[model samples]
Target: MRLLFSADGSSGDLIPMVLMAREFKQAGYDVCVCGSTEFEGMAVDFDVPYEAYPHSYSDIYLDNQKTGYIHNIRENIRHRERLFKGEFELLSKIAPDYDVLFNFLGEILVPSFAEAFNMANVKLFTFPVIPSERYGPPMGLPFVTENKWVNRLEWAAAVFSAKYLFSYNKTIDRMRGELGLAPSRNLLAENAQCDHMMIGLYEELVPPCPSWSSIDYSYIGPCIPSQPAELSDSLEQFLSQGSAPVYIGFGSMRHQNSDMLTRTLVEAARSAGVRTVLAQAGSTIGAEVEGSDDVYVLREYPIPHHKLFPRCLAAVHHGSWITTHLAARAGVPQLVLPQASDQYMWGEIIYKKELGPKWVDMNNLSQRKLRTALERLVAREAFTRHASEFAERVAGIDGAKNAVESFERVKSKLRR
Candidate 1:
């Protein structure tokens, strides 16, 4: 059977989808990945057939970097027009050949397309919370600040943004029009005409939620595969020289004041008397820091955190879900420096679990805060013990294998 997988955004988003595609290919099933043109090289590297989706939401968001919310809303409004046209073109191109279309957290488009074309589609979520939960109160929408009145106003604006600016609502209406069905309140319900809906977070991360109808949502755990990048001889030697250094890496997102952050991290490591491997990912911070023999900085590599975490005493990270899971699985205590989004929530969980110290908001981060957190994490042995136990539990779950099996099961049922 041929499977088409659609995903977008950074390497984090693309990697999980690639993991699933690679497994399907190894299992002797035909697999094609549909995603941003930017990631076509990744698909080629895995020897999977590559198809570029016509447009991407991240492209729009990245292009408009103005500070204010209204500017963002205006940019999204423009993005909606471009996205709808692009989706129509892409769906028309890929619909004829594929048996099933799998989307990794990009449920908004592919599910609607599945309904329109009478093709099977599956939604894969990499993070703990799904998008449906994210947009509302249960997920705690980010723009909803402290005040109730402001939160309500923000919600109202968000609803308007969804209807008029976001592409999801527009795409749903277009799909409905094509299907000759009246517009529906529930997009997931409307799109349940597809074969299966698979959510890729583990049960440990996200418990089961109420299903809408015949739609299937399963928490298959974290679909983590070993993606190892070659480390330089110098780097390897450095790691060997230090007592297992704490790993610090924030994928993609750049800080405005990376120099300050880097200096702070170095001071913290020095203060805590611990060595560190700082991943200078997309940030301005260079590998070389002044007066820091205990710190090593490098670019982001595909090295499995599982492998690194065992050697490391602890981790300092930007709180991306995949990183969070990997750190937890490796049983490495975490110091989450959340920049935005659900990162704060994940940080809260880490602290609550006593696996690490409280989150340091990136905006308000300082050397003193960083040093204190690291000092506490290293001083307390309980944190390390809990992390080790949690890692063992996560190691037992074969999420990628399970996802492939689940797909086959759903495909068989669809045939009948």
Candidate 2:
């Protein structure tokens, strides 16, 4: 069957989908990934066919950063309103070419696209989004709580409040109407249209599966592709220069005050008496600007996490899904600086798992606070032991293959 792996988000998000696309092709399905022009080269690198979305992800990200950065709910909805109009027009023409639309964390309007185009939908969640009493929804405020009951209450409130807060139901209905279809009967039902969902998160990180949604859920571990190569020679030399440095970088998350962030990381590492290696993803943390021997600012872009993390004392990052998994798989403790979305959830996981200290908010981050967090990460032996144990378990999971097997079942049901 023809499959369209629709992907969005940063390197943390897209890389796993690309790995799955490769797997689907290997399984002998006619598969192609569709998303931003910004990520076309990534698909090319993996030898997978790619399709461009109606609007670029950079434009959306820039707009979010400009218009109050995830706090401005009105602007967020307005931007989605503008783009989904054009997205509907594009998907209408191309969707029929595919038997199934396997969404790799596409925007919220994915269900609308599935409904309007009559596409077989399969949502591949890198992190949990569906409402559940088991865990809190990974978004703004009060995501996790003291117990499952509190989590359940939080979910009910958050989901209900979010629907009215965003007010995108009209946009959904409007998009459907424009396509000469009836308005959505129930938004939740629309979401439930998917034949299957494969959650690409480590099973150890979360509790066992509960059938919260009508469709079956597959708790596949994070799908990590094989590393491209070993670390470059200069990086090798740097790792050998005394002690293991804290690998710090916020993967692809934008840092508005990169200078301030940079200063904080270096100063904190120095205060904690540990060396630091700044990966510097879009943040000019350690880029030729007075970095000492204790602070090594990597000049290389896209350094393999697999190669570098094992050598680092701790992985400090924005708690992106992929970054969290990589850090865990490498047996390194984490210090998550959560900025938005499911990042906070991952941070909570790291803290709860004893893999790291409690996450420090970027807005409130200071040299003193970061130093304390880093010191805790280094001084505590449990964090290292827990991380190593998690890695040992993670090494056995093949989420990409599991996801393909689930899809095969979906295909069989479609045939039936």
Candidate 3:
């Protein structure tokens, strides 16, 4: 069976695809991963056929020379355009060959493309719950609001962009014309004829799946595995010498004032009287701060939370879904500092599950706030016990295996 998997964004987005690809390869199926050039190395590492697509959101973000909020807004606009163009090109090239297309969440173009190709065996996978019309506030707004303003603005942007910027509506309409189907609202509803809808997040994290007659949606839990990355000897030594340092790191998101964040973390660790390993994901946290004796600011590290969390007293992180799952799996108490996106969701889940305290918004972060969270995480023995039990639950599930099995079933269904 030949399966095509496509995704974009950070390692968090690509890692799940890679894990599923490995499972399919092990099951004696030929799996090809189509994604950004950034994921080519990861595809190769997983022994899957790597097809480098020209579309990349990160490239657009980096290409814009501007910094701070303006940079982010410009990047978002560029990303929307690139996403439409890149997905169109990729679909035209690969839609003919694959028996089934498995798309990750945030893949805005797959449904229309699949309809264009008359590919009935397409599956849509999400790392989180599907958004309702009024679920969460719209992304990239000037300010968040509990009122209807944010959602209205979000819908307005979607309409304006679809009409003018990328002509996404035209593209979809054109595809629908080719398929002899009327134009529909959004890709998910339009692609209701798809064979499966697989959700990657666990039921615990997401609310119940939406009931759709044509789509088969199931909660498959998070796909996680240890990937190989190098760790500095000094960092390793620090971890080995002291009681496992509270693991603290923001994966890829850069802090505007990294020095301030680093200092605050250092002070909090000191106040809590614990060693700390700070995973500096590509961004520097300043030379003086990086040179600290008690705090190790590491550049690259292979220490997955599965391995490190067991040794640490507690963890403080940027509240990414991948990081939250890892921390929960390790059964160590967590203190999430949420910035944006699904970070807030995971942070709320951590507190709801009684695994940690409430999330600390990064914008409002301070030494005292972090210190307080740390103190609570360390002092509460009940949190640790609950965490350990949760860890065992995580260990028992084989997400990779399940993902592969699902792919194979879809492949078999397509053949029939």
Candidate 4:
């Protein structure tokens, strides 16, 4: 069987999809990945066929940092247009040979692709941000009550943003028209609208609520990749020297004030009497690393979290799915500085679980505040113990393998 893995977004999105693609390939199925050109190297690393989308999604991410959300949405639309111009053609080119298309998040164009190929599509995601009556809203709103109407309105706001505010409906209609598919008003809805199946990358990390029971979805935990070929000698040496340094890395989060943030992290770690190894995961903070007898910043490619995080006393990151879960799996307490998107929600999850500090707003973060939080986090024995127990629980689940098995079952049913 031939499979197409079409994942759109940054490294966080692309890497997991690539790992799942690797699983398919190892299962002796032919596989190809469709994603941003930024992830081409990752695809090559996994020895899979890759088809690049027109422009890098990094443009959208960097633009969001420079501009505001409204401007970011406009730029996203522009990028999507650029993407669809060539994306459809590429899908058409590959449609004949590939039997299935697996997607990450809600690609507005998935329905059109499914229509064109007459193939089954599976939707996989990490966060439970999809509009649901189960949770208040996607961005982790405070629950005022158990009133279902209140929950429904929260979800309505999300749908309104996609369909009206972001103007996704107009663009989606145009793309469907271009593909000769019927217009779709239900393109941006409050639930997983896929006809086939949807899967969550986490297994009850933020377990789905009762309201989401009707949705055709599965919770398959996370796909932890294999350890890197080897850590750099410098990074390895630093890990050996430090007294279980605090792990600081914001995976794929482009900070507007990298210098300030980097300095804050370094000083905060020192003030708390802990060393740090900052993983400059696609951040520009590498050049700002200095004056650090107690700190080492990694600007290199492939800082293996599985290996390095096990050596850290605590973790500080952007509350992305990969980093948060990895830290939990490593049994290290965390400090989450959330910027935007589902990150805010993930930070809250960490806080609620008592495994991390409260979500520190990026706009208002100061050295003093960070130092205090770190000091408190390190002083707490409960955080580390809870994190360790969570790690033990996570170790038993094989998420990537389960996802492939789920896909096989769905494909078999669809074929029949």
Candidate 5:
């Protein structure tokens, strides 16, 4: 069957979706990914069919940040509204007819598109997105409790943000009307939409929650990709020369104060008395290290996590699900600097799970805080032991293959 995956998010969302698409393609199903042109290179590298947005989302978001959307909630909210509306128009124009719509949480409007086209659809989540009776709201909601009433109230705030801040209901209804379909209501009501919900995360890391929604769930672990040969000879040499640097990279989350953030990271690593490999993952952060030994800035290419993490004493990054899991799988302790979204949750989990020092917010991140965190990150043997244990557990995970089996099960079960 042909599948259209609308995953117009950053690397955390796109990379996993690309890996999943690759698996479906390998399984003899027609698959295509729709997303930012910034990551078109990754899709092309993986040999997956890709549709690109004219401008890179990173560029667009950075431009928005330049206008001070980073601090103001109102402007930030409206900026996102415009961004999604633009995406909706693009998808409606360019998408091909497909049997299934594999939608990402970021492109929430794609499900309405799927409904309009009469396509079988599954919502994809790299982490726990569904609000549950046992847990609470997902995606970094500050409070989660055992009380059903309390959780529901917190979930109302999330739903309210979707409605007012992002205009999710208005957008979905608008699209549905254009397609001559029924309007959507109660946008995130449990099982309000979606034929199935597939979670691509490590089963061991995900906390068990009782079902609050009837959508068929496929916890097919994380779609961890094979590392590309992106590391240069000079980069490899730099890694071998150090007493294992603290590898720092905030995957895709942006900061308007890029210069200050970059300075803070460099200074902190230096203060911790460790070598550093600062990965400028599409951010305007660092200059390439020519012969500097204390810090080697990676500006040209993304540091391959699988290859580089094992060589690092610790990793300091935005704790996106894929990054968190990969760092864990590589037996490296981390200093999670959460910038936004579900990252805060991952940072907290990493800390409680004893994988790293406490997670600090990027806005509040400083040389002193990071220095202390890195000192703990590099010196603690307990972290190494826990991280190694986690590594062993993840070493055998084949999330792509398992995700394909989940697709089969969902397809077969739904047909019956």
Candidate 6:
């Protein structure tokens, strides 16, 4: 089968989808990954065919950062407005060439394209978000109470409000109209056109929502690929320098005050007396740490969290799903600084699991606070033991293979 996989959103969104594309290829399917031009190279690295779509993920990231993280209703609405303008006409143009479409957060636009081609499409999402009573409210919203009834009400309100709040009904209808289709009956039913929707995260991190079990969804775990080669000889030597360092990185989340954040991170590690290895995704952290022996800032092409996390005592990051799972699989505790989206959910998971530090808002982060968190994270023996146990469980699950099996089932049903 010819499989077309596409993704858009932040830069971190593309990495796991590329890994999944590789899995599809290995399963003897012809795979082509489409996304912002920035991910073309990633597709090539995975030996999958590449298809270019309009927009640059880095450019989108920088543009989104200008407005800051979605902290309020207005910010969330503004964010969706920006996304509505993203040109997905490319999907329409290429839709007929593929047998099946797999998209990551591409549902908002895919409905029109799927209707245009009458194709089988699946939505693959990484976030542990579903408007179910069993799972509480969606990720970004605060969990107000432990009462299941109250939590269920929050989910209902959030989902109900999203239909109007997104304010994209007319815009999407227009897109569908242009494709010679009727208007979408309910634009808020975001994944309505998808033949299936799978949450591509570890079940441990996000257990299945009990009420949604009979629906078309599955937790196939994080489809993490095999670890790439070690980054560099210098990095290896730096790891050998002292006690295991803290691995810090905020993948692709723009840091407007990168210099200060960089300095703060360095100082935090210094105060905690822990060495640091930082992946300055797009931050000025690497520049700030120049010539510092205690901190080695990696500004390389592709991050190898898989290879590096095992060498670290703890991982500190923006609570990106891939990063957190990588650290978890390595049996390393984390200090999660949540900025946006499902990051807060992962942070809560880490804290609840007793395997890492509590969530700290980036806006409120300080050298002293971070130092104290780091000290507490490392000093707690239960954290390491719990993390190690979790790691053992995670190591046994092959989510990529499981996803392929699920995809095959989808294909078989389509054949029927």
Task: Tell how far residue 50 is off in model 3, in angstroms.
Answer: 0.8
| lDDT (10s digit) by residue, model 5, range 1-416 | 78887777677778878888998999999999888778888899889999876557765564444212244344434455555666677767755467787876555566776766677778777744456564455544333345767766766777887777666568667767887777755666632357887777776667556653465677777777675655778888998786888888876656677787778888887888999888887666774334488888877665578878888888888778889888988888888877655666788788878999888777566689888988999888999999998989778777778878888877964421
Model 1 lDDT vs. the true structure? 0.67
Model 5 regions lying over 4 Å from their true place:
62-76, 93-96, 133-150, 164-168, 190-192, 227-230, 288-291
At residue 86, give the lDDT of candidate 2: 52
Give per-residue lDDT, candidate 6, residue 140.
52
Global lDDT scores for all candidate models: 0.67, 0.73, 0.66, 0.71, 0.73, 0.72
TM-score for each model: 0.82, 0.91, 0.83, 0.91, 0.90, 0.91
Question: On residues 12-33, what C-alpha lDDT tens digit does candidate 3 reach at each position?
Answer: 7777878887887888877887
How does model 5 fare in lDDT?
0.73
Error of 2 at 106 (Å): 5.2
Compute the lDDT of residue 363 as modeled in candidate 2.
48
lDDT of 6 by residue, 1-416 (tens): 78888776555677667878888888898888877776687777778887776767666444445213444334545555445456455776787888777876534666567657777777776753445554554435433233568767766665566556556666777777888888766453455336787778777777766666556776677777575476688898888877888888987776667788888888888899888888877655667568467888898857778888888898889888888888888998888987666667778888988888777777578898999998988888989999999999878676677788888777776521
- Backbone clash total for model 6 is 0
* Predictions: Cα RMSD each: 4.3, 2.6, 4.1, 2.7, 2.9, 2.6
- Candidate 3's TM-score: 0.83
Structure candidate 2, residue pairs in collision: none
The ten-residue window of minimal lDDT in model 4 covers 137-146
* lDDT of candidate 4 over 18-125, digit per residue (tens): 888888889888899998878899989888889987667777454455213444335545565556656676776776677777776546575467666676667776
Model 5 is weakest, by summed lDDT over 10 consecutive residues, at 66-75
